[model samples]
Target: MKNLIVASALSLALMGGPVHAQTSAPAPAAAGAKASSDPIVVMRNEQRAARNAFNEAARPIRAERAATVQAAVDKAVAEAKASGKDPVVAGRVARRQATEATKPDFDAKMKPIIEARNEAMAAAKARRDAAMAQR
Candidate 1:
């Protein structure tokens, strides 16, 4: 799901072109510079590759943490329902409690990965914007 979101955002970014891109197709580069050799483009590709690797490494940890939190919520909801309380309210309470209870452990496991991904993406965006502005 995180992969899907990252892919979606990049696809949208590429398909939409730069925010200030002209409607008319751009002319060939006057400097004979290939996009493959463009530093900004290369950096973007490298950042994306790093993000993919981070996602791969973090996937199992995320899945395990999710399963643990979900199990807690399920048990709480089941117990509440068995006692005849409203499942909706019970689920809401259970979700909050379970998430809070599990947050510290989850953060310990995933926070750095999340922050690094965000930071890398943000730096890439800044680089891309600066490159576009230089156009």
Candidate 2:
């Protein structure tokens, strides 16, 4: 649950870039530190950067890959229907085929950005854990 929250927060933080740039008011500081100097603040910034980079890198490839996946799924469904499979079964098969066909390319293209984000999240988690331990 906590991990899910972290991932969601990271995604949201990254999707639109930095919050400070988007808002007129200054960002609130982290406890005991200036906002800019806070570790979590730094992590969030890093995540935003990674997200921006990923978006730029993935934009063209993503569209092409999505089209490929949709085409594959459509073909799969048509073939299954031609074989007299039930509609529900055909749809499921199509979905599975689409995922299988796209997974490798998607991972190849997105792995670096994902790794950076994961590393940032892990570091933040470690800091949070250590802080709790000291308390």
Candidate 3:
């Protein structure tokens, strides 16, 4: 009688087993639908805009620097002539001096841009490091 009860319990448990249904649905597409706008086209347009802005911003600086250097050269030539030195030698010396004089100004103008670029690169490196660590 105990054995019969055990068999009955086992049969009942077997009949009450959990059931799972197999899915016939296809897998979802790997990526979202293609962007309405092409990425390459957008990137190229952005690049063009950046170039235009850079050129516009640089124009005044270039013109000002040219004027300053020219003035320095002219002054040097005049002084050299007054001192009875060769005009060519004076012009060469003036160019060297003007280049030296402009160094500080040029560096000053570029410092912020350089620092920003360095900061951006550092941030990118940090992000990359974090991503690699996750992997």
Candidate 4:
């Protein structure tokens, strides 16, 4: 679950071509980093970067969802108290409504990122498999 969230951003990040097109002069390795010429490792780094971007993009959507849920809960709780109904049940219903309301926006916003992430992951897997077969 955690990994899915981490490795889930796509498109421009992966399309930067560092994974597929290795430069002649590699950049200096960062502190404590082990730089390599390995294609699989390069691809893995690209995937990680894409996922990071995805997570960053998701932060706003998640924030909006939280706000929406809070608003819904507040309204429902008030209504429940006025009608002498169970606040607990009303809260649950409000949460579900909030999720449903935000779901479409989430899906629309995330579809491209998700597709890109999947493509990059698949390409990496294929490259790794081919390398293993050669070995």
Best-matching candidate per TM-score: 4
Better of 2 and 3 by TM-score: 3
Worst 10 residues of 4 by lDDT: 25-34
Query: What lDDT does each candidate get?
Result: 0.79, 0.72, 0.66, 0.78
Candidate 1 vs 2: which has more lDDT: 1
Query: Candidate 3, residue 43: CA error in Å?
Result: 0.9
Ten contiguous residues minimizing lDDT sum, candidate 1? 26-35
| TM-score of model number 2 | 0.45
Off by over 4 Å in 3: 1-36, 113-135
Top-scoring candidate (lDDT):
1
- Please identify which of the two predictions, 1 or 2, would achieve the higher TM-score against the true structure: 1
Q: What's the C-alpha lDDT at position 133 in model 3?
A: 69
Query: Which digits, one per residue and each the tens of the lDDT, describe model 4 over residues 67-97?
Result: 9889999999999999999999999999998
Prediction-by-prediction clash tally: 0, 0, 0, 0
Give a tens-digit lDDT track for model 2, residues 39-96: 5666566566656766777788788877887787777778877898776677777778
- Report how far off residue 81 is in candidate 1 (Å): 1.7
